[model samples]
Target: MSEITNFKGEAVTAKPENAADLEVEALIRSVGDRVRKARDLKGMPRRVVSELSGVSPRYLAQLEAGEGNISIGLLLRVAIALDLRIEWLVGGEDPWSSDVLRVADLFRSAPAGTREKVLELLSPEPPEAMRARRICLIGLRGAGKSTLGAMAGAKMGVPFVELNREIEDHSGMPVNEVMALYGQEGYRRLESQAVERVIAMHDTMILAVAGGIVADPDTYNLLLSRFHTIWVKASPDEHMSRVRAQGDTRPMAGNPEAMEQLKVILRSREALYERAHAQLDTSGRAPEESLERLLALIEDKGFLT
Candidate 1:
């Protein structure tokens, strides 16, 4: 370059031969950034990670600063300590990509038959062990959970259960009374119990769940693991319309902000709702059309046990 005045100019002047060195430096910096970013996000102190990873704190600081040379064993130890994937520690910026790499790592370490099994589990197709033999309908109120759930079960020739009803039967109290007496936390405790009981009672069935079930972490976790959850997704307006069509004006009483309130609740829970194994959008579709879609999805996916 014409008289290097900055780092960029100096690199341009010298890097034709040193491109490999530059690439290595960039990789180091990227790894360092990822390590520190993940550590900071977890609110983990450097000393804590160092202790857990069995690496010295000084080395951890150096590693996070792109100045330390690490071995594969140390990298594995660090990954286990941070509950992260080595691929994430080394190169990827995408979390999902790291998850895929972690699966690859698992597959590589597994025994011969176990390798195939691991690959099956990692595939997008549902795994045998965790497959939803018992289907569950999950969504906000007015998303057709009950109607569609019953129809799907009927079509599939299996029993259908409403989890809220199960909760009442188990507790010997109305759901509203349970909520009023004990609050949301109390209701959720009962919900988890009901889910467990249902799983025990019937191995193959369809279950319609309460709209707010996803709000409880424990119960939601149960739903995720035990049931092949299908989210009955609909726009907030569509939800309110369905509710109103069912002649329920309670949600729309004198409050002018009823729709906004519904929207807020839907927005808050959308991410949680999305965790379901599959989603069926009922925004513009009629009940019959939506039921057909849901049934087709269940049939295509073979979620039936």
Candidate 2:
């Protein structure tokens, strides 16, 4: 108190030294909230995630509420317990990560009229859109549907799946044996089941359907509703030639009038086949040529841009 001198200078104020520590605490709380939200979005209950990730439920809850300091190992375990990716816990801005935004960006940057054309290419028929777009190729046994479908699928970047082969796989028998054992009705039932399975499993594919599929109204309607049906058509003579070229003598087997029968079959199915969205004349044309025409029609109809 002697002289009451300002010994070192004016008194300095004590600043809030724990501000950064408080902010870190707040960040941990936010992280916990985000983790809970992600868990809810995945429709997973805490118990199931805990069992799957081998994390203790009590510890997980504590981590979620940010009531306890979680170690890095515990954080990872908690993230795994919640079936969450660690990157999601640590947030960042990525507007392009959304599917809708990405698609929008693609369309916006496209050349004039290109996006519309592409939409048309990918547009499904009203019925096809509602169910599954199962593009089934129906024709006489030798119309090159399988061959042309393979080529078309390669171009379209979709899997080329044969319905008959799938039936064989399911029945564990050769197609002819299955048909013989099941009769027409039995074969049809198997075919319908196979078609349903394929439609349920896949969203986009090229289906080489059995020729008899069109004969069954229910199956035919199902196909019409689900696929951009394209009939690969050819004259009876052409069909015979193509089949013979593939070394399949079954069409000509046991019937001297096989060609005539083929003509009749084609005549009966012409109207039915005409119901397709598009048709490609396979008569005299190479598979490549027919595929080009099909592609052109698909593009024109806005199937692919």
Candidate 3:
């Protein structure tokens, strides 16, 4: 086998196979260190990040110390937990830089053997820049999309519009009444019309769509194509509490079968809900808390860019 050489041109021992593996490992360590540094700079603790990322604190510590081999999935969870991108986490470049020429130069001169390492050192684009991007909130009833979406829109300086309310406005009737009179099919048609109107009227808005929008494929697809969609999810227990708090007992309506109905509905729509660009679990969290998490996710995903 031919001998490999380090950057200093010193012949590397064949025992290590090549310098590339060492370089890659060093790159991972550097990136991990950067992540730790960034988190520290923000005055965030490892325990806080571990809670946000669903990563064990011990594992995160090991990762930051460059002593652990983490999976891409876990890395992504960490990146998102840090409100960062995988690219930004791996790359050492500033995430908020807008200088394309400088970025291009950095890319051009990277050694072919170390190119991937170089890319891994760059930071991801910041999410706040994408604040003007459209966001659509979808989920089952009582998911708190309306409350959270409103708060998110306010924080981002955008309008919060509810699709169901818009539908009511266009039809001049209460949503329940419209549904009763028009039936599910007719109500879906109306929902689609309202969605289109919202899409056309706003360049950027946070839309709190009705819970069952996904049941209408055309309307759901239209929303997906036109905006960044997030599903505000909650447990059945949370859903019941929220709905009850909103003064709507129609779900239970003194019926013992209500719980089973809810379970069935959730089970039937679980896959559809999972199709969202992001999922925010609202169970046991206040609207403001959920909004913060939603904003974080948007930022991490480059939606705010």
Candidate 4:
């Protein structure tokens, strides 16, 4: 069914075996071209990809040259290192230009609020029904989220959850140990999972989340969509004092400019925090006063209704 040039420079009808071999070779070449293009587009050097994937640079070169018959395990490593789906590397469609992939990339990078708006537009459920009386307290560490959340949940006769505590429970270790073992990115992944678990478990509850959650767009967006968020803020001085009062002096230990750093973090996150549905400033207030005010605010806003 196909013609081939013989060694004697004569055109001959290719046998079925030869045609199958040619098809295999063509597939190999196509895979190599895709790998090379993806590497170039990402600006990742062969050696860097090797380091990330634990595949040797020489093997990578051979694979990209269409000469290496790569094993599935090794290809999987490369795909993971490139932050790509394995199927994308071998699929017939051009992943970069595919409508589905392009839309997925755009949605991933969009802000949490924008993504929520898009989801709301697409979903049949109204925002109020999806949220379903879920209240989330978000602010910097020591802004009294956990303390106030527990008190408020008890007073309001609803369940209270601390996101980090849920993470710790799920991991079977302390939060500090989780941070030490997983680093920032790993911790954020666990944090996102914990948020999802809480959402799945409770439609009517109070939640206290980590301060840095806003730094993660996807997870924070998911939180905003599922919970009625309140920014529970206090002065930087109070933040430090409250943490110290809890016997955690790590924030100020041997750090002269700790307050300045806290202020900087707060300023950086101000815009993100402002996206919350409501705000409760606990600065210069007693626990009882803050609790009463939080209750009043929730009632006034009809958050549970």
Model 3: residue 43 alpha-carbon error in angstroms = 67
Highest TM-score: give the candidate number: 4
**CA error at residue 158 for candidate 1, angstroms:** 1.0
Distance (Å) between predicted and true CA of 217, model 4?
0.9
**Candidate 3 ranges with C-alpha deviation above 4 Å:** 1-132
All candidates: TM-score: 0.58, 0.57, 0.56, 0.64
Q: Compared to the true structure, candidate 3 yields what TM-score?
A: 0.56
| Candidate 3 residue lDDT tens string, 1-305 | 32333434345443335788777667767766877876886689999998867778977776787655567667766776675556777776765455843665566555544544453355353323222378898988899988988888888898899888887866678998998999998899778767766655677788998777898666676676667889888999889889999998888887989988888999999999888888889899878788788889988986756
lDDT of 4 by residue, 1-305 (tens): 44443334355664446777877667766777888888988899999889867778877776788666666667866875676666778889887776856776787678877788789887899887888999999999989999999999999899999998888876778998999999999999889877876776688999999999999989888888899999999999999999999999888889999999999999999999999999999999999999999999999998899
Q: How are the candidates ranked when ordered by TM-score, highest leading? A: 4, 1, 2, 3
Clashing pairs in 2: 120-302, 120-303, 121-302, 121-303, 121-304, 122-303, 134-226
226-255 per-residue lDDT for model 2 (tens digits): 677888888888889888888989888888
How accurate locally, in lDDT, is each candidate?
Answer: 0.76, 0.70, 0.75, 0.85
Candidate 2 weakest lDDT stretch, 10 residues: 1-10
- The residue pairs that clash in candidate 4, if any, are none
Please provide, for model 1 over 1-305, each residue's C-alpha lDDT reduced to its tens digit, 9 standing for 90 to 100: 11111222121222324777667666666676777877886789998988766778877776688665556667666775666667667764555466765765675556655654554666675554554488889999999999898887787788999988887865568999999998988788768766766775677889999888888765686677767889998998889988999999989989899999999999999999999999999989888999899988988887873
What is the lDDT, from 0 to 100, of the residue 289 in candidate 3? 81
